[model samples]
Target: MRYKRSTQERSLTSPARTTAPHVKKNVDRYGTTKLGKAAEKGDLEAVKQAYEQSPDELNQPDYAGIAPLQKASLKGHAGVVAYLIKQGCRPDVQDDQGDTPLIDAVTNGELDVVRILLKHGVNPHHSNSNGQRAMDFLE
Candidate 1:
Protein backbone atom coordinates (compact mmCIF):
# COMPACT_ATOMS: atom_id res chain seq x y z
CA MET A 1 0.00 0.00 0.00
CA ARG A 2 1.44 3.35 -0.99
CA TYR A 3 0.86 6.27 1.32
CA LYS A 4 0.48 9.74 -0.01
CA ARG A 5 1.70 12.56 2.18
CA SER A 6 -0.69 15.40 2.68
CA THR A 7 0.29 18.90 1.69
CA GLN A 8 0.84 19.78 5.33
CA GLU A 9 3.29 16.95 5.73
CA ARG A 10 6.90 18.05 5.44
CA SER A 11 9.62 16.12 3.68
CA LEU A 12 12.78 15.29 5.61
CA THR A 13 14.71 16.01 2.46
CA SER A 14 13.43 19.54 2.56
CA PRO A 15 16.04 22.23 2.80
CA ALA A 16 17.32 22.72 6.36
CA ARG A 17 16.42 26.37 6.13
CA THR A 18 12.75 25.59 6.67
CA THR A 19 11.64 27.15 9.96
CA ALA A 20 8.97 24.68 10.95
CA PRO A 21 10.06 22.67 13.93
CA HIS A 22 8.12 19.87 15.64
CA VAL A 23 6.26 18.88 12.50
CA LYS A 24 6.93 15.28 11.62
CA LYS A 25 8.13 14.92 8.05
CA ASN A 26 7.74 12.05 5.64
CA VAL A 27 10.60 10.60 3.64
CA ASP A 28 11.07 11.05 -0.06
CA ARG A 29 8.84 9.37 -2.67
CA TYR A 30 10.93 6.22 -2.16
CA GLY A 31 9.79 6.05 1.47
CA THR A 32 13.22 6.68 2.97
CA THR A 33 14.67 9.65 4.75
CA LYS A 34 18.35 10.59 4.78
CA LEU A 35 18.71 8.63 8.00
CA GLY A 36 16.87 5.65 6.55
CA LYS A 37 19.03 5.72 3.44
CA ALA A 38 22.16 5.93 5.54
CA ALA A 39 21.03 3.09 7.73
CA GLU A 40 20.13 0.99 4.69
CA LYS A 41 23.60 1.61 3.29
CA GLY A 42 25.34 0.73 6.58
CA ASP A 43 26.86 4.16 6.74
CA LEU A 44 26.99 4.78 10.46
CA GLU A 45 28.55 8.23 10.10
CA ALA A 46 25.88 9.38 7.68
CA VAL A 47 23.19 8.01 9.96
CA LYS A 48 24.69 9.94 12.86
CA GLN A 49 24.75 13.16 10.90
CA ALA A 50 21.20 12.79 9.69
CA TYR A 51 20.03 11.83 13.17
CA GLU A 52 21.85 14.75 14.81
CA GLN A 53 20.10 17.13 12.45
CA SER A 54 16.69 15.91 13.57
CA PRO A 55 16.57 13.76 16.64
CA ASP A 56 12.87 13.10 16.09
CA GLU A 57 13.66 11.58 12.73
CA LEU A 58 15.14 8.64 14.56
CA ASN A 59 11.72 7.07 15.04
CA GLN A 60 9.94 8.61 12.08
CA PRO A 61 8.60 6.04 9.65
CA ASP A 62 8.69 6.15 5.90
CA TYR A 63 5.58 5.96 3.71
CA ALA A 64 5.38 2.27 4.56
CA GLY A 65 5.89 2.90 8.26
CA ILE A 66 9.38 1.42 8.14
CA ALA A 67 11.73 3.18 10.53
CA PRO A 68 15.46 3.56 10.06
CA LEU A 69 16.12 0.89 12.67
CA GLN A 70 14.09 -1.59 10.65
CA LYS A 71 15.97 -0.60 7.51
CA ALA A 72 19.28 -1.26 9.26
CA SER A 73 18.02 -4.53 10.60
CA LEU A 74 16.83 -5.65 7.17
CA LYS A 75 20.28 -4.98 5.72
CA GLY A 76 22.11 -6.76 8.55
CA HIS A 77 23.84 -3.61 9.65
CA ALA A 78 24.57 -4.62 13.23
CA GLY A 79 26.50 -1.47 14.09
CA VAL A 80 23.80 0.76 12.71
CA VAL A 81 21.17 -1.23 14.57
CA ALA A 82 23.12 -0.94 17.81
CA TYR A 83 23.68 2.77 17.37
CA LEU A 84 20.02 3.32 16.61
CA ILE A 85 18.96 1.39 19.68
CA LYS A 86 21.42 3.43 21.75
CA GLN A 87 19.87 6.55 20.30
CA GLY A 88 16.50 5.50 21.70
CA CYS A 89 14.96 4.00 18.57
CA ARG A 90 12.19 1.57 19.50
CA PRO A 91 13.36 -1.95 18.80
CA ASP A 92 9.85 -3.31 18.53
CA VAL A 93 8.48 -0.57 16.36
CA GLN A 94 6.30 -2.04 13.61
CA ASP A 95 6.08 -1.11 9.99
CA ASP A 96 2.79 -0.76 8.11
CA GLN A 97 2.94 -4.52 7.62
CA GLY A 98 3.44 -4.92 11.37
CA ASP A 99 6.94 -6.35 11.02
CA THR A 100 9.33 -5.32 13.79
CA PRO A 101 13.08 -4.95 13.59
CA LEU A 102 13.54 -8.33 15.23
CA ILE A 103 11.31 -9.91 12.62
CA ASP A 104 13.11 -8.13 9.82
CA ALA A 105 16.49 -9.26 11.10
CA VAL A 106 15.36 -12.83 11.52
CA THR A 107 13.65 -12.96 8.14
CA ASN A 108 16.73 -11.57 6.44
CA GLY A 109 19.02 -13.99 8.29
CA GLU A 110 20.80 -11.18 10.01
CA LEU A 111 21.96 -13.08 13.06
CA ASP A 112 24.12 -10.30 14.44
CA VAL A 113 21.35 -7.76 14.13
CA VAL A 114 19.00 -10.27 15.72
CA ARG A 115 21.40 -10.67 18.64
CA ILE A 116 21.65 -6.94 19.17
CA LEU A 117 17.88 -6.60 19.12
CA LEU A 118 17.42 -9.48 21.54
CA LYS A 119 20.07 -8.07 23.86
CA HIS A 120 18.18 -4.81 23.79
CA GLY A 121 15.09 -6.68 25.08
CA VAL A 122 12.98 -6.77 21.96
CA ASN A 123 10.15 -9.29 22.09
CA PRO A 124 11.07 -12.38 20.14
CA HIS A 125 7.57 -13.74 20.48
CA HIS A 126 5.97 -10.62 19.09
CA SER A 127 3.87 -11.29 15.99
CA ASN A 128 3.46 -9.29 12.87
CA SER A 129 0.18 -8.29 11.24
CA ASN A 130 0.15 -11.70 9.58
CA GLY A 131 0.56 -13.41 12.96
CA GLN A 132 4.12 -14.44 12.17
CA ARG A 133 6.45 -14.12 15.13
CA ALA A 134 10.18 -13.46 15.09
CA MET A 135 10.81 -16.91 16.48
CA ASP A 136 8.82 -18.37 13.64
CA PHE A 137 11.54 -17.31 11.27
CA LEU A 138 14.36 -18.83 13.28
CA GLU A 139 16.32 -21.63 11.65
Candidate 2:
Protein backbone atom coordinates (compact mmCIF):
# COMPACT_ATOMS: atom_id res chain seq x y z
CA MET A 1 0.00 0.00 0.00
CA ARG A 2 1.22 3.56 -0.79
CA TYR A 3 1.23 6.13 2.00
CA LYS A 4 0.23 9.76 1.57
CA ARG A 5 3.14 12.18 1.75
CA SER A 6 3.25 15.23 3.97
CA THR A 7 3.16 18.70 2.48
CA GLN A 8 6.88 19.27 2.99
CA GLU A 9 7.77 15.93 1.43
CA ARG A 10 5.40 16.56 -1.44
CA SER A 11 7.01 19.94 -2.00
CA LEU A 12 10.45 18.40 -2.11
CA THR A 13 9.44 15.88 -4.75
CA SER A 14 7.09 18.13 -6.68
CA PRO A 15 7.50 18.68 -10.38
CA ALA A 16 7.69 22.39 -9.55
CA ARG A 17 11.07 21.80 -7.94
CA THR A 18 13.77 23.24 -10.12
CA THR A 19 17.37 24.32 -9.93
CA ALA A 20 18.73 27.47 -11.50
CA PRO A 21 20.47 26.65 -14.78
CA HIS A 22 23.30 29.12 -14.24
CA VAL A 23 24.13 27.55 -10.86
CA LYS A 24 24.67 24.17 -12.48
CA LYS A 25 26.51 25.72 -15.40
CA ASN A 26 29.05 27.63 -13.36
CA VAL A 27 29.53 25.46 -10.24
CA ASP A 28 30.98 22.52 -12.14
CA ARG A 29 33.64 24.67 -13.74
CA TYR A 30 36.57 24.56 -11.30
CA GLY A 31 38.83 26.65 -13.47
CA THR A 32 37.78 30.01 -12.03
CA THR A 33 40.39 32.63 -11.11
CA LYS A 34 41.39 33.53 -7.53
CA LEU A 35 39.05 36.51 -7.49
CA GLY A 36 36.23 34.41 -8.89
CA LYS A 37 36.73 31.74 -6.23
CA ALA A 38 36.79 34.27 -3.39
CA ALA A 39 33.73 35.99 -4.74
CA GLU A 40 31.92 32.68 -5.13
CA LYS A 41 32.75 31.83 -1.51
CA GLY A 42 31.53 35.28 -0.39
CA ASP A 43 34.91 36.04 1.23
CA LEU A 44 34.98 39.82 1.07
CA GLU A 45 38.39 40.10 2.73
CA ALA A 46 39.94 37.55 0.42
CA VAL A 47 38.36 39.32 -2.53
CA LYS A 48 39.94 42.59 -1.41
CA GLN A 49 43.36 41.00 -1.08
CA ALA A 50 43.04 39.30 -4.44
CA TYR A 51 42.09 42.58 -6.06
CA GLU A 52 44.97 44.38 -4.39
CA GLN A 53 47.46 41.86 -5.68
CA SER A 54 46.14 42.14 -9.21
CA PRO A 55 43.78 45.01 -9.78
CA ASP A 56 43.62 44.40 -13.50
CA GLU A 57 42.19 40.97 -12.92
CA LEU A 58 39.12 42.36 -11.21
CA ASN A 59 37.06 42.36 -14.41
CA GLN A 60 38.64 39.27 -15.91
CA PRO A 61 36.51 36.17 -16.61
CA ASP A 62 37.56 32.64 -15.74
CA TYR A 63 37.98 29.79 -18.22
CA ALA A 64 34.23 29.27 -18.02
CA GLY A 65 33.66 32.86 -19.06
CA ILE A 66 32.25 33.72 -15.65
CA ALA A 67 33.67 36.77 -13.89
CA PRO A 68 34.06 37.56 -10.17
CA LEU A 69 30.98 39.78 -10.20
CA GLN A 70 28.89 37.07 -11.81
CA LYS A 71 30.08 34.53 -9.26
CA ALA A 72 29.40 36.89 -6.37
CA SER A 73 25.95 37.66 -7.68
CA LEU A 74 25.30 33.99 -8.34
CA LYS A 75 25.99 33.16 -4.71
CA GLY A 76 24.16 36.23 -3.37
CA HIS A 77 27.31 37.85 -2.07
CA ALA A 78 25.89 41.34 -1.70
CA GLY A 79 28.96 42.84 -0.09
CA VAL A 80 31.26 41.43 -2.73
CA VAL A 81 28.98 42.67 -5.45
CA ALA A 82 28.96 46.13 -3.91
CA TYR A 83 32.73 46.14 -3.55
CA LEU A 84 33.27 45.01 -7.12
CA ILE A 85 30.92 47.68 -8.43
CA LYS A 86 32.53 50.33 -6.27
CA GLN A 87 35.94 49.35 -7.58
CA GLY A 88 34.80 50.00 -11.18
CA CYS A 89 33.84 46.54 -12.35
CA ARG A 90 31.32 46.97 -15.12
CA PRO A 91 27.88 46.13 -13.77
CA ASP A 92 26.74 45.00 -17.21
CA VAL A 93 29.63 42.75 -18.14
CA GLN A 94 28.31 39.59 -19.78
CA ASP A 95 29.76 36.10 -19.76
CA ASP A 96 30.08 33.85 -22.80
CA GLN A 97 26.41 33.00 -22.34
CA GLY A 98 25.64 36.73 -22.42
CA ASP A 99 24.53 36.77 -18.80
CA THR A 100 25.31 39.82 -16.70
CA PRO A 101 25.64 39.97 -12.91
CA LEU A 102 22.08 41.24 -12.86
CA ILE A 103 20.95 38.16 -14.75
CA ASP A 104 22.92 35.87 -12.47
CA ALA A 105 21.51 37.44 -9.30
CA VAL A 106 17.95 37.35 -10.58
CA THR A 107 18.13 33.76 -11.82
CA ASN A 108 19.49 32.56 -8.47
CA GLY A 109 16.78 34.38 -6.50
CA GLU A 110 19.34 36.67 -4.89
CA LEU A 111 17.09 39.63 -4.18
CA ASP A 112 19.63 41.60 -2.20
CA VAL A 113 22.23 41.17 -4.89
CA VAL A 114 19.62 42.12 -7.46
CA ARG A 115 18.78 45.28 -5.52
CA ILE A 116 22.43 46.16 -5.26
CA LEU A 117 22.91 45.76 -8.99
CA LEU A 118 19.85 47.86 -9.75
CA LYS A 119 20.85 50.56 -7.28
CA HIS A 120 24.17 50.71 -9.08
CA GLY A 121 22.38 51.12 -12.44
CA VAL A 122 22.77 47.72 -14.05
CA ASN A 123 20.79 47.08 -17.20
CA PRO A 124 17.81 45.02 -16.16
CA HIS A 125 16.56 44.68 -19.72
CA HIS A 126 19.71 43.03 -21.00
CA SER A 127 18.96 39.60 -22.46
CA ASN A 128 21.10 36.51 -22.26
CA SER A 129 21.95 34.29 -25.18
CA ASN A 130 18.71 32.50 -24.51
CA GLY A 131 16.87 35.80 -25.05
CA GLN A 132 15.58 35.88 -21.51
CA ARG A 133 15.69 39.19 -19.63
CA ALA A 134 16.68 39.49 -15.98
CA MET A 135 13.09 40.32 -15.05
CA ASP A 136 12.01 37.08 -16.71
CA PHE A 137 13.59 35.14 -13.86
CA LEU A 138 11.61 36.85 -11.11
CA GLU A 139 9.45 34.32 -9.34
Candidate 3:
Protein backbone atom coordinates (compact mmCIF):
# COMPACT_ATOMS: atom_id res chain seq x y z
CA MET A 1 0.00 0.00 0.00
CA ARG A 2 1.14 3.50 -0.74
CA TYR A 3 1.37 5.66 2.34
CA LYS A 4 0.33 9.26 2.22
CA ARG A 5 2.84 11.93 2.97
CA SER A 6 3.01 12.97 6.59
CA THR A 7 2.47 16.60 7.57
CA GLN A 8 6.22 16.97 7.73
CA GLU A 9 6.65 15.48 4.28
CA ARG A 10 4.01 17.76 2.85
CA SER A 11 5.75 20.73 4.33
CA LEU A 12 9.03 19.55 2.93
CA THR A 13 7.63 19.43 -0.59
CA SER A 14 5.71 22.67 -0.50
CA PRO A 15 7.16 25.97 -1.74
CA ALA A 16 4.70 28.52 -0.42
CA ARG A 17 5.99 31.01 2.10
CA THR A 18 4.16 33.41 4.44
CA THR A 19 4.94 35.54 7.46
CA ALA A 20 2.62 36.50 10.28
CA PRO A 21 2.83 39.87 11.95
CA HIS A 22 3.11 38.50 15.47
CA VAL A 23 4.76 35.20 14.74
CA LYS A 24 8.33 34.30 13.93
CA LYS A 25 9.25 34.17 10.23
CA ASN A 26 10.60 30.97 8.71
CA VAL A 27 13.40 30.90 6.20
CA ASP A 28 11.24 28.95 3.81
CA ARG A 29 7.85 27.29 3.45
CA TYR A 30 9.17 23.76 3.03
CA GLY A 31 9.12 22.81 6.69
CA THR A 32 12.70 23.99 6.75
CA THR A 33 14.71 27.01 7.69
CA LYS A 34 17.27 28.50 5.33
CA LEU A 35 19.91 26.18 6.69
CA GLY A 36 17.65 23.15 6.38
CA LYS A 37 16.85 23.96 2.75
CA ALA A 38 20.49 24.58 1.98
CA ALA A 39 21.45 21.25 3.46
CA GLU A 40 18.66 19.43 1.64
CA LYS A 41 19.81 20.93 -1.65
CA GLY A 42 23.42 20.03 -0.88
CA ASP A 43 24.56 23.65 -1.18
CA LEU A 44 27.74 23.45 0.78
CA GLU A 45 28.48 27.16 0.53
CA ALA A 46 25.05 28.11 1.79
CA VAL A 47 25.35 25.63 4.61
CA LYS A 48 28.71 27.10 5.49
CA GLN A 49 27.34 30.62 5.48
CA ALA A 50 24.39 29.65 7.62
CA TYR A 51 26.65 27.86 10.03
CA GLU A 52 29.04 30.74 10.19
CA GLN A 53 26.20 33.10 11.04
CA SER A 54 24.66 30.75 13.60
CA PRO A 55 26.49 27.71 14.78
CA ASP A 56 23.29 26.54 16.48
CA GLU A 57 21.59 26.21 13.10
CA LEU A 58 23.47 22.97 12.61
CA ASN A 59 21.35 21.34 15.32
CA GLN A 60 18.18 23.37 14.94
CA PRO A 61 15.17 21.58 13.47
CA ASP A 62 12.73 23.13 11.05
CA TYR A 63 9.04 23.69 11.75
CA ALA A 64 8.49 19.97 11.25
CA GLY A 65 11.25 19.10 13.65
CA ILE A 66 13.55 17.88 10.89
CA ALA A 67 17.08 19.01 11.47
CA PRO A 68 19.56 20.15 8.83
CA LEU A 69 21.49 16.96 9.27
CA GLN A 70 18.38 14.87 8.74
CA LYS A 71 17.51 16.81 5.60
CA ALA A 72 21.02 16.37 4.23
CA SER A 73 21.04 12.69 5.09
CA LEU A 74 17.60 12.10 3.58
CA LYS A 75 18.70 13.69 0.31
CA GLY A 76 21.91 11.62 0.22
CA HIS A 77 24.12 14.66 0.79
CA ALA A 78 27.00 12.95 2.50
CA GLY A 79 29.14 16.07 2.59
CA VAL A 80 26.43 18.17 4.18
CA VAL A 81 25.57 15.44 6.66
CA ALA A 82 29.20 15.05 7.59
CA TYR A 83 29.60 18.79 8.01
CA LEU A 84 26.54 19.02 10.23
CA ILE A 85 27.69 16.10 12.34
CA LYS A 86 31.08 17.68 12.67
CA GLN A 87 29.30 20.81 13.90
CA GLY A 88 27.77 18.68 16.65
CA CYS A 89 24.42 17.84 15.13
CA ARG A 90 23.13 14.66 16.71
CA PRO A 91 22.54 11.90 14.16
CA ASP A 92 19.93 10.17 16.30
CA VAL A 93 17.49 13.06 16.55
CA GLN A 94 14.02 11.88 15.53
CA ASP A 95 11.56 13.88 13.49
CA ASP A 96 7.83 14.07 14.28
CA GLN A 97 7.59 10.55 12.83
CA GLY A 98 10.43 9.33 15.00
CA ASP A 99 12.71 8.68 12.03
CA THR A 100 16.35 9.35 12.67
CA PRO A 101 18.85 10.40 10.02
CA LEU A 102 20.20 6.85 10.01
CA ILE A 103 16.69 5.48 9.48
CA ASP A 104 16.12 8.02 6.72
CA ALA A 105 19.38 6.98 5.06
CA VAL A 106 18.41 3.34 5.21
CA THR A 107 14.92 4.02 3.93
CA ASN A 108 16.30 5.94 0.95
CA GLY A 109 19.02 3.33 0.20
CA GLU A 110 21.78 5.84 0.91
CA LEU A 111 24.61 3.43 1.59
CA ASP A 112 27.26 6.13 1.85
CA VAL A 113 25.13 8.23 4.19
CA VAL A 114 24.37 5.16 6.27
CA ARG A 115 28.06 4.44 6.58
CA ILE A 116 28.81 8.02 7.58
CA LEU A 117 26.10 7.93 10.22
CA LEU A 118 27.28 4.59 11.53
CA LYS A 119 30.86 5.81 11.71
CA HIS A 120 29.65 8.69 13.82
CA GLY A 121 27.98 6.29 16.29
CA VAL A 122 24.37 6.63 15.23
CA ASN A 123 22.45 3.76 16.79
CA PRO A 124 21.77 0.98 14.30
CA HIS A 125 19.14 -0.77 16.41
CA HIS A 126 16.89 2.24 16.92
CA SER A 127 13.37 1.87 15.54
CA ASN A 128 11.09 4.42 13.91
CA SER A 129 7.54 5.24 14.90
CA ASN A 130 6.51 2.35 12.69
CA GLY A 131 8.73 0.12 14.76
CA GLN A 132 10.98 -0.63 11.80
CA ARG A 133 14.70 -0.64 12.36
CA ALA A 134 17.33 0.68 9.92
CA MET A 135 18.59 -2.80 9.09
CA ASP A 136 15.05 -3.87 8.21
CA PHE A 137 15.28 -1.72 5.09
CA LEU A 138 18.63 -3.07 3.97
CA GLU A 139 18.85 -5.24 0.87
Which model scores highest in lDDT?
1
lDDT of 3 by residue, 35-88 (tens): 887899999999999888767566667667788999998999999988888888
Q: Give the TM-scores of the predictions, in the order they appear.
A: 0.82, 0.77, 0.79
Error of 3 at 39 (Å): 0.3
Ten contiguous residues minimizing lDDT sum, candidate 2: 9-18
Give candidate 3's whole-model lDDT: 0.79
Q: Which ranking of candidates, highest TM-score first?
A: 1, 3, 2
lDDT of 2 by residue, 1-139 (tens): 9998544321122234332333324333444567788998999999999888767667777655678999999999999999999999988988879999999888889999999999999889998999999999887
Q: State each candidate's clash count.
A: 0, 0, 0
Cα misplacement distance, residue 84 of candidate 3 (Å)? 0.6
Best by TM-score: 1
Candidates' lDDT values, in order? 0.84, 0.81, 0.79
lDDT of 1 by residue, 1-139 (tens): 9998554534454433232335344456655678988999999999999999878788877766788999999999999999999999998899878999999999999999989999999988888889999889877
- Clash pairs, model 2 backbone: none
Candidate with the larger TM-score of 2 and 3:
3
